[model samples]
Target: MMMTMATAAAVAVEDSTTDDVQPLSTLKMQAAQVAMDSGAVIHASPDVLGKNGEDSAWVTVNVTAPSPSAGHWVALFSPADFGYGLPSYLLVYMFANVSPSFMSSGSGNLRFLVINQRSDYAFGLFSGGKDNPKLIAISNKVSFANSKAPVFPRLSQGKEWNEMAVTWTSGYNINEAYPFVEWKMKGGESSKRTPAGTLTYTRRHLYSYQIGHELPDGTVVWGKSSTFRASPFPGQDSLQRVVVFGDMGIGQRDGSNELAGFQPGAQVTTDRLIKDLPNYDAVFHIGDLSYSNGFLAQWDQFTAQIEPIASKVPYMVASNVVVLCRCSGNHERTYQDTGGFYNGNDSRGECGVPAETYFYVPAENRGKFWYAADHGMFRFCVGDRCFSSVDRKHQPWLVFAAHRPLGYSSNDYYATEGSFSEPMGRTLQGLWQKHRVDLAIYGHVHNYERTCPVYENTCMDGKSKQDKGSYSGAMGGTIHVVAGTGGAKLRDYSAGPSPQWSVVRDKSFGYVKLTATDHSSLRVEFIHSDDGAAHDAFDITRDYKDVLACTVDSCAPHTMAN
Candidate 1:
């Protein structure tokens, strides 16, 4: 059952404190003064009061704390309930400290103890030092059991405001899921209540709290307070925006490099991109990410190269033919030929070399090389560069992406078909017509091209386009786009009247940004790396009224392409 917040009767504390604790008062005064200096405001009361019988209180405080330092404290206690056994949750946010591990540096601290109850278990945020802000868990009332540390680009300093939040998902379910407590220390050591045994949480009934912190002696200070219940899927409410491109091998075609005209080889340029990555939840690698040539060392370097970006977002991939061809016929060839497949098996293999790691799709779709995932209003259909059969199931949304384009110009000597050709055009075109995929993306052309919505070589008029296509009114007429211009060598465009189906084509190094505003409208823009210019863009809208409604027989295979 879904959980909802209940309005519990508020019970004001009668005595306020069991005993007038001088040390606690002193600490509060010092924190308040420091917060005032740092331009922060401290509320005199709790930010949130627990519901009746729910034993929990959250208070926000201001501290004028220096950054990169540690050891500060805040206290929380319920006046109505003094005994233990009734568990509660807490969450804190740091509004000032941006240091890598500000939590431990005393940027923000929290302390809570059951007046009469023994602590069971606890899970929330903590910072060990300037380098160790981690999500820690304690069990069995002993040592730290689990921790997830943040991987920041570099140590942070200054009065930059940052936030540290904690949520306790379970308090009861002792023995089954142990109870715990979390607290910040006055000096440096942070404390957490340990559980008697192991604990596991099925439904996340997270109780949240937030507060603000400040430091005066150059000690790290942060501010925070509970906001609202966050969505289980972070970033889901935002439109699913993704930058798709591939074949980026270190350098660029234009004088400026990756990320739209950023200076070539400028570390800050890449850093900026990494820092801004949270704006988008995922990325699609059409192919040729590192030009590693199946060399484990190169692959390692490649991974390291994109660590700044990959560490934060979901990096999805399609295969690159060059990576495949280079390793072909060698002992390494067997292992690298497939997208992480081994000996004809779908499972990933350790091909004796670090570069032998295979590319596996997300686990949700059976880890098949091809799969589909819906982000907000748009559904992305990712296909394996090698397998066409996977396209059968998800054909309706077969907005295919791979290293090679089914249709291409002959300007490049390698554009012709050979033994490796799988006739993707014939198969995908039939399927596109049957299911009417909205868009197909590919790399390997080493350039960029946007095709008019087309099927069987015929341009689809906007008026003729259907809102619901074969896959529920969810899909529209399919358009194919190529965005391989990510620093790799550039290829000349195919000479001619540019197929009637071609809408926009460019040889500049760049990336494509896709924005889905709703079920029927999508906006795509091509940003050039040469001048940070938006070279081309277009809007594709579906007329839901034109979509053929699905029926038992209408949804059959005959209605779809084989």
Candidate 2:
């Protein structure tokens, strides 16, 4: 199972009352709710109180299927249209990468997995496609409804081409149904069923989102491309381009700027990404992804808005939870403080603990969230060459996506707190240098700034061979970039004097575009969200002098070892 460079693809309501009708409040007392099969129809009634309050309370009328009568509710489209009007590349990618459907209910839970031969990241190929997608977890056929998984699948789950995985969650730990995903590629004749497992997942989950622009002919719908494999071009072995940005808050619907018609920040960015689909292979939403820290629903809207682009490609993401206002910080920041954003321990409780108080960190969040993520990913990306390789995108370049700047970036927020390095707090700074990381991409300051290749507040050695707006990363310093202009409000530079190593800064709504060339060179560009302008561009030449060759024993010569 060898996978090459990843690729990009362009990128859920209820019911009514009837004999199959019931009330949600009944959910509390009844042992269980309706037990229906996939695509089954059921009705629900809302509890209504009248003139006499509790004494005279009455139930809202349940209309027939989709009647929309008082208290009537219905589930549309079987599991509901995850997304539609997708292009071809996206569909193929999903079978190897993401989930096509997810369901759970009191009757039972369903977790469909797309397992394949483990992937060989070196070439992005799998020896065998999975038998049939498996339902890793299921409850019973009675309650065939379930929510989506809680996290996204990691880029390395199916490390072997013969062993990919599609995972989901069940509301209940108990099991009942002999679960399976009976599926076939669209237009094929028969569907097959492969048995699923009932186990607690200690990893990522998947949720569907859509992003598109309205056109006279028709709206190019995109959503279901939630999970997709990373593939190289017909002859190439690396990605040609990838989009990067951060601090994207779901745009508000106002009559001002940042909106294309009624669409706002997130929507605007989504539309841009979709239209430019073929030009880029993947997306890197570094940090501060959804400015919806406080209101989690904003996360829903942001994802839905970006479906057209995200579904078709591998959307890699991280976290940023500082200065997010109280509510937002309450939910998002905990991941950073206690390193347990997803799973909380007694020390942190539901909220997170302070810096040094915990005896031990919880298992779930330990390897996943915040700055700890930096350490985890550092090792993941810088690991071995073949079998145990996690950061398989090792050939062309090594880029890091974090929420805050690790070096000087012309930002003002932390200037008064005594320079940019203080907030960074040493942990990330050390690991980066040790790993010899080439590029550091961040968002948070809301403005874009480019720093000369620098280390320890000093220019390491090289300078761009090209002009200012377009330079070479081959320069001796590590290029520090702040692409915070994704969609959040902009921030001005600190009052006086750009740092000695600061090269350029742009204040606008835009994102980044990266191109990898076969010459072991990486070209980075900043693209505007409003107008597709190349505000900034640069190239970094990667040195693969010692990149090891892969094999069980004997191996071929290294392509990148110069």
Candidate 3:
């Protein structure tokens, strides 16, 4: 295992002419750029790490520079867009002279066992845009003096049905092994465990792991919007009861922890999910699943806290990624402890990595967070507008989820930090409009809000609230909903008359429930997770006459070429 972790990976950038790097036709990650500094050039390549007639398809990572040469070796991930930063770039092995370990591979590469225990890491949502790694360390530390806990989080490939990458965080150098997951039909009895495969997520650096006491100083950097998060499979085709909301605080890492005494929004929601298990099938957390900015423990606490509900229903994550990743305003780079504040990726201790590790034990037995990633929210076309029915299973709707609000939102502090609309929101507005999206969901701003059926940033269909919410028409305008009231600190609508586009807005600890009524009819209601009050709602009747529908068969999940 130690030998495989070292210099066994493939792909190293070489001079334009002759080189030893293998062909790039089939590999998912190929080194495409090499920036030289101080006469020192970086070199590395991948070699199959399979053993005993078995093929794991895994490769070794090789790094090298001329010996006795006057310079430092630096290998940068390429296209300057793959988002390859330290978090995703794990330096498991280093060449002999540049060693940082007690052992070396047969090929002379030093090996690194990055994480040791659950208390030692954290990874955030896909916060590092373009250069976002799958995971990163939030707190890299090992404690023989104190007992610690870990977290579990399994991400859907975000591009395929029933496909997920279940990962565990926190394995010590002494106890090295990856977590395993066993899944079957929701109602099936017993099944064998399926290895979701283990990935060495770490702090981005020459020696990615924490070395004794130095504490990792870089964030992992995986680039470009490679894939989507998780969601339920084929649920779009049936009449499924779904929960929609964002900003479910994982509890504050700062001294004030709502989980200790207060009823956190996530807890309230979990309590409700328990009592009303049959009433829903999945959850769509638009954004802020865990507010574990830098405190990796928060990720552990939040997943453990929501186990009851998330285990049974699919909890989908939006905002973690964007459509096509055209810009950087996805909100992952803001927080001081995580994100771009990661100080050049030297270290991103925990972007929310522990959730994967701590939960794997019991999480394997009790059920874990669920959600599949589907990126078919909108369809863009030029002269002759195009609209495709999304679910071939006769499901007729297109719902969009994001962390930040694109329209009909009261903005305040986020803009100052460059998260609200500088990039993501504005970048998506046109795409949403072009596709004539039906429902748009968000959570970053912590408050519950619903906009009048709107299009082109205008409240085209005005607003009306029957005993249940009602909209004038369906296909013409896109309804925008914000349920950020998920237990974190609440914020007031900006200090001014509510925007005309906003129909119902409230400051409450709640979430929105969406029901796909039929081919042309869908209903959405915002319910306070605290008390069972149906605070707000709206229904859309598919014009059937004009909405373009993308058949489920026609729209395979989105995949990244790189």
Candidate 4:
């Protein structure tokens, strides 16, 4: 059950001399050939001839759908050697009814399936005449939602066109809702349902869905096109790695300038970081991506500059303190507020944008800003930028991270007293104490300070006024390390004499390297950017009971008198 259609057009190729070759008359043919010797139906198009060889040529192929249960498949072949073990050529397959719209409603859903010949990294791009755009995810049948399966293989000189099949199940009527069976791939066999003794997909379980085949180094590469296939499983794993950061607005000197140093030159650092991102899992930006004080142009520049990174990765963001808007008496409404340094002093009703936003890390914890991920033995507790709540179920070994810090040096400029004014301080502290969170990583501070694990301003030491070094062995303390000096301006350090909780403090541009040894031991190293050397290092170990023994009772919080 197969139908084929092909169209021929002239294409120009560039030669070594950088001159466009003359357009040649090319007849593009596409046919369904079942056996090698005995050919199947051959679909041919008229030969396309052009006067100039300097132009590009395009050919279109359309294939018919198989019977409801016939399981039809399609593969594209390059002109050089359409057969296996041939030269390198691009193979493209196109299908009809890729996304059918329903009559009752205007919405339509499109699905595609893609497979690679060997293990090589590839991405897909879509371009058309219209501006209509939508979100899409590529995944395999088994782990489409969680992308646990390795990517499809890549095509070497020996390998031929890899088959990418898209199977469509007719959509039901608008009023009807059907339960599709879930699909599972185990030991390379597709399983419609879990076998008698097989393990089924669980909410807490983490699995990899391979979009294509994996390379020798376990790197999965995707195909260039979108293919849709019906899977036995109800849902597919289509997750990608993303990185998110916000509150990176343009400021006069303090805010923007400082932030620029760390992520300097608008898009320089951000672009490089984004470009260097390892095909990420996903990005969750809390807020303040770009400061939209009054003018829309600033926002445009920031967004445009960030496109390099955001376009590649899923740029999930929240609102922040810098966005401008208005305040309604009863119902808070936000329009464009152009009342900042960049924009004119017109009262254009610009209000600061609200930041507490949310996105999902599918196959992981969902519906919460604070989510957990199991990267190696360490469980990363990425707190909601708002730092409001914590989910205990998803992440077991909690290691929290946020933009703001609850504790800090007693610098008058940005005093620590009012820093934790938001409920985040109490909420996160309580959660950390309850779960014995191994490490709490934070930014925002211009300086870097590592605090011995202390709760409620009290170091775990029961002794008071003890020598500075006396409280060194305070076990189980939540080490509050500040590594905000990624590239930000260095803040002035004012170390208190015999400070009880503050273990180490440094005013330098640097980043922290966190290595998780296991569920129990974790190593944190602060690398100073000046010399590319680690200035400070520390080790934190959890007890057999899984509780961090360090408490605020031992090392008392520093007071003005001390």
lDDT against the true structure, per candidate, is: 0.38, 0.39, 0.41, 0.33
Best-fitting candidate, scored by lDDT: 3
lDDT at position 68, candidate 4: 13
Residue-level lDDT of model 1, residues 414-446, one tens digit each, is 334421113446655555555545677777566
Instruction: Supply the global lDDT for candidate 4.
Output: 0.33
Q: In model 2, which regions exceed 4 Å deviation? A: 1-229, 232-236, 252-264, 320-331, 335-367, 370-394, 418-422, 425-427, 462-475, 546-562
Estimate the lDDT of model 1: 0.38
Give candidate 1 misplaced runs (Cα > 4 Å).
1-238, 251-272, 275-279, 320-360, 364-368, 384-398, 407-411, 414-422, 462-476, 547-562
* lDDT per residue (tens digit) for residues 1-562 in model 2: 1111110110000111132111111212122223223432322222211122111111111111111112211211111222221111101111111111111122211112111111100001111123211111111111111221111221212222222233321122223222232323334335333334211222222222211112245532111224343334222444456677876655532211113321235556666777887787556665555443232323333444454555455555543322221111122333323432222221122232211111111113322322212111122121112123224244435566555565556676656654463254244544445445567777766788887766667665444424444433234435778887777567688878877777778888889887766536667788888878788887665445422322121233456765
lDDT, residue 518, model 2: 57
Pitting candidate 2 against candidate 3, the one with the higher lDDT is 3
lDDT of 4 by residue, 249-335 (tens): 332221211233323433333433544545343343333334333333233334334434443333433221121211110001123
Q: Which ten residues in a row are the worst by lDDT in model 1?
A: 149-158
TM-score of 2: 0.51
Q: Please give each candidate's TM-score.
A: 0.46, 0.51, 0.53, 0.40
**Candidate 3 per-residue lDDT over residues 475-515, each given as its tens digit:** 45667777777765666666666656667878888878877
Off by over 4 Å in 4: 1-288, 292-370, 373-376, 382-397, 409-411, 416-428, 461-474, 486-490, 493-498, 528-533, 546-562
Arranged by TM-score with the best first, the candidates are 3, 2, 1, 4
